[model samples]
Target: MLSRNVYPQTRPGKWSVLLLLAVFSLLIVFALIVQSGQPFNLDTLFDNGWAAVVSILAIAAAFGAFIVGLYTIFRNHERSAAVFFTVSIGGLVALFVLMQLFL
Candidate 1:
C-alpha cells in the first residue's frame, strides 16, 4: 500500500495561475507579430492592430495575475512557485506601464 505524505504541499491559487498563463500566452502572440522580420517599434504596433490589442490583453492579464497572486498568498495561504512567478510578472507589467506614462 502507498502512504500519503503527512504534510500536504500547498499549490498556487487556481485563478492566479490561469491569469499568469493568459499573460504569457498573450505576450508571446504579441511578440510573434511584432518580430516578423521588419523594423520593430511603437509604429509597428500601430501598423498591426492585432498586436496592439494583444498587448493590451497581456497588460490586463498581468495586472489581474498580480492582484490574484497577492490575494492567494495572503488570504488563501498558497505557497507555491507559480504564485511568486505571477507576482513578479505582474510587477514587471505594472512597471512598464508606469514607465511609459511617466517617461
Candidate 2:
C-alpha cells in the first residue's frame, strides 16, 4: 500500500491580514462619512489637511497590505483562500485609488 504525505496548510502572516482588515475598515468609515451627506467631497478632503492626510495614509496602508500579502504567499507558502482574495482585490483597489487621486 502506498500512502501520500499531507502537509499542514500554512496560514498568512499576521501583518498581512491585519493590514488588509484595517484598510477595509477605513474604506467603510469613509463610505459612511460620505453617505451622511455632510458636505464632504474630494475638494473638501484636500482643503482639510487632516482629511487629506488620512486618505493618503489609507492608500499607503492598502499598498502595504498588498505587498505583505504577496510576500507571505510567495515566501511563506500561504494556503489561505482569504489571503489570495485580499492580495488580488487589494492590489487592484490600491492601483485604482492611486490613479483616481493623481490622475
Candidate 3:
C-alpha cells in the first residue's frame, strides 16, 4: 500500500470573511452612488479634501490586498498574504479613525 499522505485542505479563517465583507460593503456604497445618479468622478473625489482622498486609497489598497491574499491562498500555497491583507485592512481602519478624529 502507498504510504505517503498529502493534500491537506484548510478552511479559510476569519480574516478572509472579514475582508470579503468589507469589500462587499464598499461595492454596495458604489452601487448606491450609481443608482443615485451621482457621478463618481475625479472632480468629485478632489472636492472632498486630502483626508477623503487618502482614505479612499487606503480602502482600495485594503480591498486589493484581500483579493490578493485569497488568490495566494489558493494558488501559491503560502499564508504570508494573510499578513499583508490584515495589515492593510488595519491601516484602512486606522485611517478612518484618524479622519473621524482630526479631519
Candidate No. with top lDDT: 1
Query: Candidate 2's error at 53, in angstroms?
Result: 1.9
In candidate 3, list every pair of residues with a backbone clash: none
Put down candidate 2 lDDT per residue, 1-102, tens digits, no spaces.
954223224444567667778887777766665566565445657765555666676777778878888988889887576677668877897879889889
lDDT of 1 by residue, 1-103 (tens): 9544322134446777788888878889988887877655555556778888998898898898888888877877766777877788888888989999999
- What are the Cα lDDT values of the candidates? 0.77, 0.70, 0.53
What shift in Å separates residue 79 of candidate 1 from its native position after superposition?
Answer: 1.4
- Candidate 3 structure, TM-score to reference: 0.36
Q: Would you list the rank order by lDDT, best first?
A: 1, 2, 3
* lDDT: the better of candidates 1 and 3: 1
> In model 3, which runs have C-alpha deviations exceeding 4 angstroms?
1-48, 81-103
Give the TM-score of each candidate.
0.73, 0.68, 0.36
Clashes of each: 0, 0, 0
Task: By TM-score, rank the candidates, best first.
Answer: 1, 2, 3
Off by over 4 Å in 1: 1-12, 35-44
